[model samples]
Target chain A: MPEPEPIADFYAVVPAGGSGTRLWPVSRAASPKFLHDLTGSGRSLLQATVDRLVPLAGEDGVVLVTGAAHVDAAREQLGLADEALVAEPSPRDSMAAIGLAAAILQERHGDVVIGSFAADQVISGRDGFEQAVREAVVAARAGYVVTVGIAASRPSTAFGYVRSGAGLGVDGAPSALHAVGFTEKPDAATASAYLATGEYRWNAGMFVVRTSVLLDHLARLRPALHDGLRRIAASWDTGADARARVLADTWPGLEKIAIDHAIAEPVAAEGGVAVVPGVFGWDDVGDFNSLAALLPSVDGSGTKILGDTSAVIRVESAGSVLVPASGRTVAVLGLDDVVVVDTPDALLVTTRARAQQVKDIVAALRERGEDDLL
Target chain B: MPEPEPIADFYAVVPAGGSGTRLWPVSRAASPKFLHDLTGSGRSLLQATVDRLVPLAGEDGVVLVTGAAHVDAAREQLGLADEALVAEPSPRDSMAAIGLAAAILQERHGDVVIGSFAADQVISGRDGFEQAVREAVVAARAGYVVTVGIAASRPSTAFGYVRSGAGLGVDGAPSALHAVGFTEKPDAATASAYLATGEYRWNAGMFVVRTSVLLDHLARLRPALHDGLRRIAASWDTGADARARVLADTWPGLEKIAIDHAIAEPVAAEGGVAVVPGVFGWDDVGDFNSLAALLPSVDGSGTKILGDTSAVIRVESAGSVLVPASGRTVAVLGLDDVVVVDTPDALLVTTRARAQQVKDIVAALRERGEDDLL
Candidate 1:
């Protein structure tokens, strides 16, 4: 009935990256997936991410780590203070991004517990999300690197899987269990078999750990990268000149590694990782088909529209997804399970059955040297 | 081989109508099918029709019959003089449009043998078309209402069929034959059966007859419509004011009947009609499927584009008809036999198998009162 107050000493780190090549024209390199309102909720995914985090981390406790090119857009959309926006000079992948944020929090806020969430994910059921994050914070306080593993509703091969072992039997977290290991995206048969076992959950890449804990693990696992990130974090809050000098000197040399591989998997192998079951509905909106799944069906025919419903006209076309972003009328006839995304500069036509192949279109565009569209 | 000289006393009547709802977005009511270049041949279909006819009838001998709303575009595209353009106040179907043209040509040029060609049809093999028109004109001078019947290439259920009787043996027109009867668009089974007998040919509605003969037949078959057309024709050349007033008064009262019902079927039944075999390639460009059939394939995969080829990017889609009229990049992925039309104000997505049902989208648009899009 009522939302819980902000957790004390908890900070959120939103690492915004990825061009979403499968989503194509809607998610261009110039304006990526996190900046788009894929859910028709009137707020971009980045803003929605911050909105979800503010209840747990408080207004001033959330920091964003994004590319230097996107810092202005991130600040404009989130209305974050300069100190709260960490602009990466260039992409060194997730390990450097999340590690730098963790080290900087350790420097400025004295080893506060931090949770890393992606800026482009879609989640529903606020109570379940908050509850999962609360349990994750509890495990983090117990000195375990915690991950929020989403309930596997279907045998989907689009995401990695995290296996749960014995229950943690910890005090404040009843849903916490020992995370045995992590696996990359598997084949359909393997995913189905994984679903058959009740021990697997979708590894949504949500990690909550003390800033000092993550830094210490990074120092032992990837010492060079960890030392480089610590060097950049030392001057992050000093002055513009010193911060720019440190970022220019150290960020380029950091290792390009995902947090899952560098920290989650290795530390997970040592039995120091814990998993909290997240019953909330979640999606990364990786493709147009996934974005369609996030939208509410507009009619009894299962037609989904991301933009103005009145702009779409369907005849004998059931289960169609239409995004009319150019203020133009979209008419779909005699086609079932069709996807039509009509933007100003580009239009995409495909079927839901073959939606995963849309990345091929982007590749084709790239091969044709149509960089402006990409 | 050199081309033939213009035939003496031969005039051409071009009727440009039909919204082509099946080719929506590319063929809107404001700029119907004839105004579009469905073949990507630089010239609009109306211009191509006139280019084909100018050799049979002299450069100044072609008359265009179209709605008053489209007269300016037709004139600009055809480069025709004011007297060569016949603008109807409103649509009264094919009979009034063609009959009025006949009456006007009779008043101005005196009993000239005229051939009626739709402005939207695509034809190939110039020598074959010229030979067919030459034979039809000879039969028309012999006092027979003549029609050029396209050789049925397939058992297509999309068009009407004409049955040919015994040969006419008319001089200078060895290919002319007596017309038995005409059948409306039939079912697939009926069409196949009709093709099995070697007598049926596609009725393309290309009529060649002396103005006096057509008027006499119209008067005998439907006197009221003939009188109304004659009344409009008499004032058509009097003055602009008188022409407009007469059209407003008489055109609305004319019966809305197709030439087939009003003359061709009745004349054929009475053994007064003749058929000229058209062996050349021909298509009405009736829908996206037919349009695809007319375009040259951009690749061995059978993908067809009716606009700039560079504007379309196809991946794993075969036999797709794409019209990128909006100057936007259109990417189609993993769809076979799909039809995508991207225009400035509207878009259409469908499959070639369902191309005939595209008119249902127009109906849906009208039901939504989206007249601007239509």
Candidate 2:
């Protein structure tokens, strides 16, 4: 089927950040998870995210917001025009990132609807993703903060959940529902119970909102942060010097808050948030174990290789995740559910069950002042 | 304690062979285990073996017999004189390696008692080892093939077992006993049963016997191999060209038999074999798990590092063996009893329980034409 026509009056804003400490050695401070091709898809996660959004938002309507240090890399990978990229002078959390994008897009083209998708996430079922975004755009145009709630595939405690109340009864967004509440990562039992209730969906941190609506919500909920982002966005397109001046002046002072707490939670409570069912498969690709789930098994033993298969030699080893990124041969013997991530400067060996604890290793390295490895 | 005087007419024949496939990536065919410091003792196993014997055999009495390709490396590490090193034209197993050394020593010194020790075994308790060798030398002078049998520390199935029988009653060799028989690596149940019997000891492949007695046994049991070694030994001292000519002509055709099958087992049946109890701590360092036992715990968690400890970072990982020989930082998280052998060109990740299966990985790599990794 041909690609769906670009959504009218809609812009896609991709906020690429997070050090992804748990995926260390592969995901590091300088290059993080979004810059690597975690899925062996040839395209980096940031590039894949832009690729997914460009057709929906139109080539010119897609905007990228990333840390200043990563601007060159993200631009080189995505090949986005300079004006379409927004580089934050410093990390001020998701609020400043997405808000700055929404404000800048409003400054460039009137108050258009902007969808905020994290560049580090993985999503499949492109048609389903497009349909959800289309419906989310309609809900956003109807003056409600819209979040695409992923169909909870598992009772995972890795992500927060969004609770749908009643159908929004919007003309174009048939699956849109009134978002009643948002909850942080819940306990295992609570997540299972939420799954049983059929109303909870994984909050993928994806928000589609009209520029005016998000700015109004942010102004009411976090005035200082809203003012700082607006000031930065106002000069973003004026000139490189002016943009740099405003960013350096305002970005550092912006409140460090995730978008969830800044707007989604309060707005949902005030009956101004809508949840569109995202039937597409989605994952944050949090750790090696989660990465194993995203990768296809390379052999009958369920071994997954993210790099050169020829570089890995497994004997009686099953359910292993091997990342032979160092251009060296890796030999695994009689181990099951093992994670071996080999890089040129560092190597990580752990088990699938212990993948999340990789962050502890990174923390210990930091504590020991091995920042070069981190 | 003062060092004991050199034994009278005793020569040390160190057969430095075996690719140590079970310890691959570190123990390659080119370098092998004997050339590696698996115990982190700052000396290669071959060097330590020679160090242990230099005092007992006198500097000129110690001879190193290894493959032609490894001669230079062994000589570089050992600094042995050209006359003290025997380089085989090709691998012909233990019989050729040890017999060649015995014949050469006898041809030079006239029927001297020669002690054959593997270059790859690790031994502690220097005094006990010295005592055992001294007693074995006496037993060897009394016309019996003497083997040092290590006291069974555990019911390990990795090595063969030597069953001790009646005492030899040789003066000055009180610990020497008539060897009843030898058993290859047994099943767990048989190994446990062998350990229960007070008579069984781990066979460490150490043989002490008069060169005349060993050559005579070879003549009686396998005259062709004996004649071939005698011819090689005859020309070995004539000149470098003659020695190379004889070795190239005779060495390749020699029988490829381990000493146990060629002499030890059959000689025991004829009541000519004796075993001197070795009270020293010993291990072949068969695999990473066995290597772990040789290394002192680097942390309270019982983690063992065989190379630069600073290159390894462990978190919640207990009882793991790490060989960070690549000069790369190896981070291990939440894995117990895991073996991570990191090298510049190859890596091995396995568990202590499956350490023996590492050879299987090497075999698989070889099967896949990845001989460079092997």
Candidate 3:
């Protein structure tokens, strides 16, 4: 396909440190989000994210940013080349996780372009995604931070959006656009209106920018973060300082904010950001409910499960989800649109209408210290 | 109490030759109602019935009557003395089952009184039940078929009733009443009206009668049954009439009919039956639904289940009879008056409104040849 244009300059950096409570029970404290092979793709979302990035960044250039607590699982599962992972001393939110990666890359590769990616996501049409990221890189190298935008389908109030502007050139060079604006997750009416505009894209929390560009932008937009990151990088050579001193001091001190709010939007509002439409399908597997939706349909009618459920049921009971085996002869008589998740210590039954609340149920369970179920 | 009344005349003849599809999973093709130790009471209902008789029949007279397939379980669980046990050729219904027992007793014991009882019934207050049966016998010895009437507390539409007439005779015989009339299970309004009158007593399907009295009544009333019974009994000892075997040739040919319709009610309607009210709690453990009502409060205020219930749940889900421990763990949540029955191969989650139809469900399952569930 056009000799498959080489993906260079841009390195993909995944922030793999989220303790996603939204997928508790299934995704637990011991082995958190990035390690869950939730989509049954035979690879954790983190591994898949890395694989997806390899096409866009060339294998040797990809790096992962995760917490000290999770570094072991990350290394054991992702199997990357040497010096490819950065473990934070403690976990901070997106801003710090991203800032650490950018600062680390800026010192190592100078002004090389990097794409910030979240680990919990699914993407299809890699060829198209690579093309989109390469296009985004052009904008990033031309002195603008470009956040990949997933074209909006429905009025999902759960995600932030980028409002598109005019195209820049034929080669899409410097792929410039006077970005209209950025909106954090909106209310229903605002999202509905945004959806109608056709140019709004769900902010995938993914952004493309040269290492120097992100750090330089952070210096201007959040000076404290820029300073802290520089200090953290200087001590990396000692390696010992990386975990105990540098990260402990840096992660907790970095802005408790999203990258959009702390850097890109602030930079964009000042007329220095670009938006590139993501041409491939991408999903942030934010929770089990969403994760179930993305996995290969277990029933051929959309059922996904894991484990031995023979002890659970022996009949489908007319289309119920029995975890372990989606079609374990379980009888769900008089029940509809329900999920029967049978685990060793606990079982859960809730309709799809309330599936999102399972995490809340698990939260209450955790609060009671009934970790047996967890 | 009154020297514990000697626990004598305690012979129990459980007529279990009737196939009751009303109880399926437990009462199956090879094993029927009387064979089931449903309550884990250390004694099955039939076993309990025998124990009830033991106090009076003095152990040796505790007789068990079951169909051909169930003869082994009945005898094994009841531990009846040889010749005290009776096996039918097939399910000939209670009328013929009771007839075969009566005729066999007629030639062998001469003028002995007999207590004919259903095997699938739960009776508490054993001392009180023994007294009630003894009282019924006293009345029966004086030329009457004493049908024990359970003291009716609720206007339940699931049972037939006996109209208790004014008291007569002495011991005060206060318990004995002339059975003015018999009524089959009535509609709600009629049962409510019957309850208001206070003259109705639930038909317990238990009878105490002098062998002579029963024989005379059967000969006068259901001639066909009496003749069939005679032929069956004649076959019991004499292998002479090859085609007249009690457990072989006759049982399957005997008309399928309830003892109530075939004899008791017919005699009561003809003014030849008497009623004796029983204070002891007696329950026909007819179905899992009935088990809920009869078993000691399954819970202080929620659902109760027996057997393997991993398959059954009664959420809020209260008042359900889940049988998961019959093999599985049955958990009920957020439901009220639900019946979750978990079996090895079958599970039933039904609402209280449809509790009566559980038999229908079992029937449909049988018709579908879902034998595993059955």
Candidate 4:
């Protein structure tokens, strides 16, 4: 086999500034979800994502965009050189975080192919994942904002779907289908129908694009965010003040939209989208139940028990033994499909079906004047 | 009221020393149910019990009989004098523990009235409790094993009942008819019938008896334990050696039997047993459900929520919020009659019904080589 292309030029733009109440005790103002060592595997999701990106990006090209509040922590975790972090003043959506990263990356490395990935997802099949990413890089170089499509394993209503079109082979295209159209998450029935058709792919929020290319695309598609991003990039203090100024004055003005909605849908509707098919084991690590697939099961019940230490879990005089720790251990007693998480200030015991509502719990906490938890 | 009989002079014997798994994370092998600070009131049940007993026993006269492993912690909590502890070498049944306490008390202050109580129980009506102890003291001096009978409020299958005899004088003489006649824990229908009669009292396990009278009763009833206790007392090291010998030889031989079965039944069957009727707020605090009743209620639901600074006890997150340090703030998503205990080591999400089976969970953990949690 021929040697792989120069992977060191592959860069990563991680949007790490999503503020949420759902992952409270673990992910707070100072410690966001990406920085959380949820699996107790020494490295956090952000750290793990960096580690995963290392084979491609060589650490120098890795870019992390976070809220002003978590800039210091994000920097310490990624261990990057100056200009690696594109700190935002406030949390807009993925569109702003992604756009800001692209502008900064263009200034440093001239139009390098960048992989804009989330810091929270977990992917297996490392070789296949790497290969899929490499294919996206070639499509990106050919002037297409490339998106990876995961084959549907279940009728999951949590993600948007991408329907494939005819293969478009220009040059150096990896095993992939050409983009037909992208669908935002559908209702349960639509999701079930999509799963059965085999024409749908899970929208994984992963993309490969040229930095010069995404900036030009955004300038034409969403000009307000594009103009604000240009000015913030010009006034780069590389300090905390720059972050505060950008957040207080500019960030709140940007329309809160996912990149897929602001850019990918419009591009796909025009039939110029390139889809990278992935058979790799991938997980978004979306909720507590999703962790069951990423970590070792605590019991035979696909329950995951993860904590920094064992003292954090304690099962009473009953047959359960759970200690108290930041790690998570699910004890499936006579009851099944439950997730019990214990933190220092609060305790969460919820069913998997209601797991998505965990975010609502965080929202409720915020409304109740429990500022400390948030 | 009535000057409380200048605090009844007696040696108190507490027979509960074993670890209960139901209240797992808080309760441990070294620290069982009695030691956990469930109320967050800065005192444990053991501390509460000692505080309740000290005035009655003239401080130093109170004796505590507990398992050997807990002798140090029990001493730390009680601050009893050197001679106050009658530590068992191994765990024996209540029959042996009662006999042991009586033997030691008889040796120290001959013919003194002895009050046997449980360290883990909570009692209200302090003045009434003291008054009942005084009455029992009078009966004990009169050579009757005085059992303080709590008036049964509901037909509970958890406790044995003391059948009230024909009305007696303040002197506790068997003038009208017989003494206590039966020990019964009836079924629901049977218990309901018994409740309607108003002749039955919950066997509170609070017994007042002359040391010599109890020894005599034991000798006639359980001769082997009676003989074993007497011999162990004779060789007992009012020094450390006695404890060593008690643990080495006599302890394992003592039969594990409750006082109701071993001594009270025989005395009631024989003669001269006085049952002092009481309506005090006497609760065993048996499991989470009953234990919840003891705490200050929220929304009149008879539920409690103990959380750290970061937790928000929401409308839906009632019934359970045990924040055991570690600062892990738990968010109860959607639960009412559940206990969400978040420890740093483990997370327990359980209903009150299954809480009593917490030990089964501990057992399963141990079987799975999770002994460190136990």
lDDT per residue for candidate 3 within B20-109, as digits (tens), equals 455555565656666666775656677777676666766567566776677777767766666787766566677777777777777776
What are the root-mean-square deviations of the candidates from the true structure over C-alphas?
1.4, 1.4, 6.3, 5.1
Q: Give residue A112's lDDT in candidate 3 (0 to 100).
A: 84
Q: What lDDT tens digits, residue by residue, belong to model 3 across residues A1-374?
A: 55554466667889886666666545666678778777666888888888878766776878888877788888888788647878776666777778777877777777788888888888888877877787888888777888888877679876888987887452555444556679888999999999887878888888888888788778887899789878887776566745467666666767677787888777877877788887778777665556665755445444455454332322223344445422222334444445555433344455555555656665656666756545
Task: Please report, in order, the local distance difference test score of every candidate based on alpha carbons.
Answer: 0.93, 0.92, 0.69, 0.72
What interface RMSD does each of the candidate structures achieve? 0.8, 0.8, 5.4, 3.8
lDDT of 3 at B228: 76
Clashing pairs in 1: none
Residue B164 in model 3: shift from native, Å?
5.8
Q: Evaluated on chain B only, what are the TM-scores of all the candidate structures, in order?
A: 0.98, 0.98, 0.88, 0.90
Q: How do these models rank on lDDT, best leading?
A: 1, 2, 4, 3
Which candidate, 1 or 3, has the higher lDDT? 1
Q: Fraction of native Cα contacts kept in each candidate?
A: 0.99, 0.97, 0.08, 0.47
Clashes of each: 0, 0, 47, 63
lDDT of 1 by residue, B2-27 (tens): 87789999999999999999888788
Poorest lDDT segment (10 consecutive residues) of candidate 4 chain B: B170-179
Residue-by-residue lDDT tens digits, candidate 2, B143-211: 999999999988888889999999999999998999999999998899999989889999999999999
> For residues B136-197, could you state the per-residue lDDT of candidate 4 as single tens digits?
77767877777888888789887888787776665543322235566566788888887888
